[model samples]
Target chain A: MKNNLIKMAIFIKTERRVFFALVFLFLVFLINQGLYTKNKITSQDCMDGKCSALVPEKPQLSRENSFYYIDDLFKNRPSGYYRLTFQEKSNETEKIILKLNTYSEKESFVGELTVNPSGNFQNQEIFFFLPEGFDSLLFAKENSDSDGNIFIKEAGISKLNIESEKELVLLKKTVIGDTKTDLIRESQLSADYIYPWLKESKTILGQIFRSSDEYISAVSFNIDINKNLNPGSRQYVLSLRKVKYDRENASFDGQIIADLAFSAASIEKYRQNDGTFLFPIYGMLEKNAHYLLSLDNSKVSVDKQNYLEFKGSKNNDSYGGGSAIIKKEKNIYIIDGDLYFKIYGAEFHQENGVKILNGAKIEDSGKGMGKYSYAAKGKFIDLLDLEISSPGMGFSEDSKVITAEANDSASFNYTVNTIYPIGKMNFSATQLKAGWKKVSVKYSFNQENWFDMPFSEGIESRIDSIDNMDNSENSDNDSSVDNATDISAETTAQEMIQVFDFDIIPTMKEIKTVYFKITYNPNDESKAHSFALKNLQITADLKMK
Target chain B: MLKKILEILIFAITLAMGFYFQWEIANFVFFILFIFLILHPIPSRFAAGSAIIFLLATAFLTVFKQNDLAETVAIWAYYLMIFTAMLSFGELRKEEEKDII
Candidate 1:
């Protein structure tokens, strides 16, 4: 019975010891887990391609460490206009030139921009067209021997859509005349003059033509300066005038419709009869009205060795619409051939265009820039580009949260330039916690005029009412370290979902680029307060074509 | 002497393999430890000493890498406690048997 008791006592002691060891192991496991959580790394919070979109080089770039460029995974990029934006600062003012070069053995240059960076960091943007074969992009200091250091970061290139087309109109080109040398006929009236008399207002070359188009943007004249051996430049004035051809009083005069001055220096010297000179005539001309296109070198007595003239097909009536005529000191000489000319102006045409954004009809450029369209369907796009100005405010690495440290009056800005015109945007700010005194939302198109966004529906006014009540309650209390924190209904807050609905003005919508700014001002309490915007969303209103 | 040396060689190599690979090496340690339980079980006198040596090695490697130290030590401590308890119970049973004899 005593041996049984002893054995039972030994077994009980062993059981107690095992139980204590388990408890100790459990405590150690808990400690290890806590440490593991503190040291967790979120892969520096970068998603695939997004890290490539905007790169801040880990090392400081300087003259010695000069070259910084991005390939942008060129395989996915299409031939389109791309705008490169970067933040740069220099110890001293310096110029960094960005050049887009080709990838071939021959160093063919494409485009370039010289940026002047000051001591303070500044964001600069330049738009350039990307063509095939010109894939290399490099930024370098103008001087290789500079002592100062320049840092460039957040250098990103985004594809942009050009809404304006300049080279779309060229339908009014007359047949090229080469049979005759129907010149401006610059010759001395007596040959006693040093410079030719026709170089003066004595000789006026005119072509009377009518157009069905309402606007005339520019006029082209085909002439070879290969014949003119003049070393100095000569000024030629092109004038368009309303004509009343009575066949009686022949004069190159009327109320001047439009006139363009051309210098001999701009025309390629000693070149064949080719398309070179373009006279800029920007004005609205009456459709089907007879207007005279005259070229005169009355700016100076024409150079004896260098005078302006145009090529023509002699004895051949090439242009049935207009004939080449020259007036020499009141004599209107008619030539059988017409001078080769072309007129370019705006035209109207009906065509298909992009109608929606990010929809199935668009090709993915990998830049998130969807179909370029005017009438875009409504979409709730998550704003990713965040710029925080306060020292105590920043994006939590995954960019899911805009974290606000204590007393952080943070201005979070997101810039968006969409192809579609924004009519109304729906913004929802989910405030996780609140010690914020006031939260105001404003937006600007030009960054100069900021208008307060009015809420269409949400709990913003309720928050304001709560804030006012809290303010009244705390108005009489003295702020002391020993004084207990007066937790009003405002301080006793759960999550607040404030939705901001604002209709953009028509003028601002025309601007296309909108800078959305939200500022949250936290209360100046000594406690380390933290709050976050769980998410902010933007819903672009759909437009009906 | 050769038998003792062979037993230690098997034990050391299996444990080191267990530490290197989490799954395969763990099975190897299990196989060798079971074999040793039949062939050359750890005496209670050396159980505390062996556990301490294992803990020092765990600490040294943890500090050298500074990665997942807490988890590694926790695992080592749990297994060491189990092995020590088994050894102590075996010693207790042998002592009881000798007392009966």
Candidate 2:
């Protein structure tokens, strides 16, 4: 019995030691886990700061209108008598006068008309004035400022006389400076433009399928011109001159009616020859000063390069510049120069801002390659032949990238590579702990041809280092001392810097060439704008290897 | 005592292998853990630890690369939890012998 008791005692002692060891191990494991979780949170913070989209809200009252008027006289007025034959006896001679004024002018004007419905819908008359003489047109064109004014090309006009009134009408009004006419036309022209495909269409059960064709029934224009002008010392005037139609044709296969017109064409060109509608326009410009003009749905052709684009409605009250989208295509083209204008012309200067320039507010395009498809803005001249190039204040280079820094302890673990064109990029430095941190990006056209492309400015780097400067005994004393030392040091050291290695080489392609986007964030808040380009490059030599 | 230590070392090697090759043993570990939790009168925390190790191993494999084995192991683990819940409900009315089994 004594021997058995001794053995049991020995066993119990050993078990106690093992249990204590296990508990110690458990505590250590828990500490490690807690540390890991904290580090994970820090890493998430870094990711959020770098790539998350935090776009600023648009201003409440942005200068939204692009229409500027300087020339007092009309360039092209409607001369020929317009005869309209309506199904009902509708006869009326409407004398419509185009007025001009800046937003600051504070005066409004209107035109009067009489409607008389007569014989058939075929012979109806809607007579108006226009700039008719080519010399007068050129002189008038030379007279106005060259800001953001788009001259309407003859191809943008379409007029249709429908035999049936049951045809549905679709209205689309793009910003005056927008140049995506083909996309709009494609979306508007196809029979599927308004209706879904038969396979994709859902039946209401009561409605039956029919083989009847649909066409445009009526066309109208809603033109709004707003300009801020000063009278005496500053010649502030606003004028809306009628534009002329270049061609009129009908379609047999029901493809679409294609019509083109000059910038001087009546507001009626806002409608298609097929009687489709484009309406509710907003035009604005400053009086006696340089202004930009934007043509709606202008057409331009890119030399086989895809570019970033914006497509959305402009708010009536403010100008947040609509949302932007990127489009890729082999050939880039604009519908016309309808949205192109400049404020340098004689009419724009001497006319005292009388002629209300057509279109919307235009962005300044600095010295850059301007193609029909892509538009660049800045203080320099546009290298590409754009309809309008307005020179304005240039933006800072650092303004291109968004950046942020987090205060206190932080860690970064998972490093995600923003996928870009040449190849996939990986970060060697994935984990960043406390203390001042640094990162650099290398850019290249080919995966093997990496070049050091450094960040010029606006990149913030920070480190959460231990602050042992506070020598205090009390808890409050310690907190205050450390807070003052650390916060002050952080504020002083908060400088954003970005640097990359690069001797960027452009690649040439044999067959199909494309510009590839490597990596990006859809919603990054640090950026002042909506988008950011880490290391973007464009060249004809860029091709798929 | 020396022989017992050697045997334990060998057992540890098997555990490591089971953890590394989670696809093969993940379902088994999940099943054993369920049995130990719901059916066994005594709660075996050791069994829970083993199951967690197996789960971590599987997660590590899937997180690194795309693999069918890791996907299969994860799916099995989810189904096992559901099955265990159902079996515990059925055990409520079972005879003592059936419950013990």
Candidate 3:
């Protein structure tokens, strides 16, 4: 009985010792956990500075008589033609034959061009050419109701020098219809520098001008600037007269207005050190104009400053239907609306800036999460403002980014490294609390959190290659289970391959926005967030002796 | 005789509880202690004879059945009896040496 008592005593002693040691170990663990919790810091606990961000400006379009280009190779412009008659007075024949050269042998004749009895001529082609030194060859008919001019040269004439030793002046003249007299009268400045029959035959006001450098030159309705005006500041009132077609009752189905008022709002300027400037002003004008008004000339000239031009084939009385749009493979564009929101701007920024940017707006659209809550180091980020503030409790580490996992009711925060200013920020979590349910991001600046949208981050791609099985037949009955698995598979492999054809699938549809909390690291100046030190200002003036 | 029986009873109870608790190592230890106490009450020669039987049984059961409840109990009994027999053999050896001297 005594030994039994002794044994029981020893057992109790050992048990008590073990229990105390376990309790001590547990207490030590708890103490360490408490210390860590106390030291935890959050975004709000850190200092504050400017919450700086860059909001992209919305893209716009404009149009003018400016040069826009598709590639570096193609050059385009618009030109117009007026009455140009060739003549030579014949002394013997008593009759004159009028002749003009068609420049191209393989002429794609647009339409029938003719000089009417009224002497009003029409040229369908906007572009025309002449051989060298054909200047001063255009002349007006001398007699009314008479073909008084004869051709010194035939049509399709080769290069000819018609230069005179005495300077010859080309005069710009206007022809008017005289309905009362039922006869068209022609007048010109005679060799004596005066109109001989001005009092006898009513003379239209005419002006003589020097010929330009190019004999084959284009004459179109253009703004005649007395003084050069800055492209952006220049504005004009343009009025287009209704077109009169020669073919009566014919379909005047084209809708191209000859004149347009324009301003350069998006000119990309490049300033040289010497103060000279070169930029793609025409491309800017065309893009912005067509984007806004849908009337950019399909053909645009991208050469020379202050010499921008646009040309388009008339269709539906406008530039449309099979018109080539400015296609850029990839470029960046600034996007902004009434309110500058990060996700809002990013949603509209596209890989190819020329293509349209389309995405859903979570704000006011009622399509996305309306609210979010986050807690990091006892600090919370306000969902509406996305600003962080301390909860007056635990602390967070400096220079670390607080990753917030937001749900309908609860949000958890984890700290991560800083992300780039322009790229994506991705976050993931595997372990979760009970009744965790599903988690979707309210904002993820990075593509790591993909949103499934067809038009935004999706493209149509066809399957290029596929795996197939041969139809040739062979079988082995004496085989193990693993070998039979391969053998029987061969029996149906050909049919399976034929059935399982490849189809295109969307890889990622949409990207979520990632919100980052700034970290304040005291040890590193460069690595620290800009707002790590909230400036305290005190201004005063004093005089010292 | 009553004391001896009581001693055996207490040892058996200890072994039973220990095995129930899955305390296999503790049971063997207590079984050896019980053997030492039992040999103190028996004639030295008889104790030696019983020790061989106890050791054989213990080796057989513990090695074969391992942690089986029934077999574990058998091992406990075998160890306890073998420990008592070894104590008795020590005394016998002492007696023989004394006689030879």
Backbone clash total, candidate 3:
35
Span of ten consecutive residues with least summed lDDT in model 2 chain A: A203-212
User: In terms of TM-score, how similar is model 1 to the real structure?
Assistant: 0.28
Pairs that collide, model 1: A180-A313, A180-A314
lDDT of 1 at B101: 100
Q: At residue A351, what lDDT does model 2 achieve?
A: 20
Q: Residues A1-545, candidate 3, lDDT per residue (tens digit)?
A: 99999986785564443333334334534543343222211112221311111232221111221111112111121122222222122222222212221223121221222333222221111112332322222212323244322222111111111233121122112111111111111111111111111111111111111111111011111111111132222222121112222212111122321222232321111122222111110000111121111212111111112222222222221221112122122221111111100000011112222211111111110111121111121111111122232211111111112222121122322221111111222222211111112222232335255332111111111121112111111111111111111112223322211111111122333322233332222332221111110111111111100
What order do you get sorting by TM-score, best first?
Answer: 1, 2, 3
Please list the residue runs of candidate 1 whose C-alpha ends up more than 4 Å from where it truly belongs after superposition: A1-201, A224-234, A245-254, A269-280, A328-336, A348-421, A424-504, A507-545, B1-101
In angstroms, the error of model 1 at B97 is 99
Interface RMSD values for all candidates: 29.1, 21.2, 30.1
Measured by TM-score, the strongest candidate is: 1
TM-score against truth, every candidate: 0.28, 0.20, 0.13
Give the alpha-carbon lDDT of every model. 0.47, 0.24, 0.24
- Give candidate 2's whole-model lDDT: 0.24
Q: DockQ score for model 3, please? A: 0.01
